[model samples]
Target: MMYDQLKVLEKTIIDIKKKYQLVNDELNSLKQKPNTDPKELAALKTQLSNYRNEHDSAKKQLGDLDKRYQNLAEAHHMIGEEQDKLHKQLADLQRKNSELQQHNDQLKQQNHDIKQQNHDLQEKNQLAAERTQVVLKRLTRIDQMEG
Candidate 1:
């Protein structure tokens, strides 16, 4: 029975000490609260509002810069596509130029062949005229002998 009474007394002492600590903490908080002046609080509020405006302005400027960067990226992509198109056109033109060169070479060869044929025909015509002259001379000699 005595032991139980001692336990109850010890518990009461612990609870009282906890209550005293809580009251002291509350008193200290109240003392500090009174030291914060209204003017200082207003000044802090104004500074916070200015910082908020500056932050918002910076965020808007960043958004505009991002938009400009995206536009530049799109323009660069379009330029790349145009460059590819020009390259393909250049290749096609090169192919056409080679084909034209081949056709010109064939025409030159045909002209050379025609000139050779004309030379051969002129030589044959000269030989036939010489044979006719020889035959006429022989006929004139025979007539003179018969007379």
Candidate 2:
């Protein structure tokens, strides 16, 4: 987009330059022409004055356009820098996501191991309860004989 604007500005500058040169040449030609009639000379002077005014106006416009073009170029450069920063941010986020995924996988494996350990503890508790029950029954029988 900036390139296109610059191209258009360059073309406008070229056109304005051509017009200025043409006006200058015309004024010079009028100066060289041999004049007899005062009225004709006055008319030529008026025409030259008009041409000079037009040239001055064109020059002012060209200056304004040049300033605008410079501003646009600066804006374009800033936009490019911003784009580069955003691209870097995107890349960093992607890398962080990858690391998080790896961490999540590790946590999942740990969870599975903890569940297996819980199951083993439950089985051990059941066996201990059965042994206690058997010992109680044997003690009750012994107590009755003693009574």
- Who wins the lDDT comparison? 2
lDDT agreement with native, every candidate: 0.71, 0.93
Q: Candidate 1, residues 29-107: lDDT per residue as tens digits?
A: 6546644778876775675566556555655655655565566667777988999999999999999999999999999
TM-score of 2: 0.80
Please write out the lDDT profile of model 2 over residues 1-147, one tens digit for every residue.
Answer: 789989999999999999999888988887788899999988988998898889889989999999999899899999999999999999999999999999999999999999999999989999989998998999999999898
The 10-residue segment of model 1 with minimum total lDDT is 1-10
In candidate 1, which residue pairs clash?
Answer: none
| Residue runs of model 2 more than 4 Å from their true location after superposition | 1-3, 134-147
lDDT of predicted model 2: 0.93
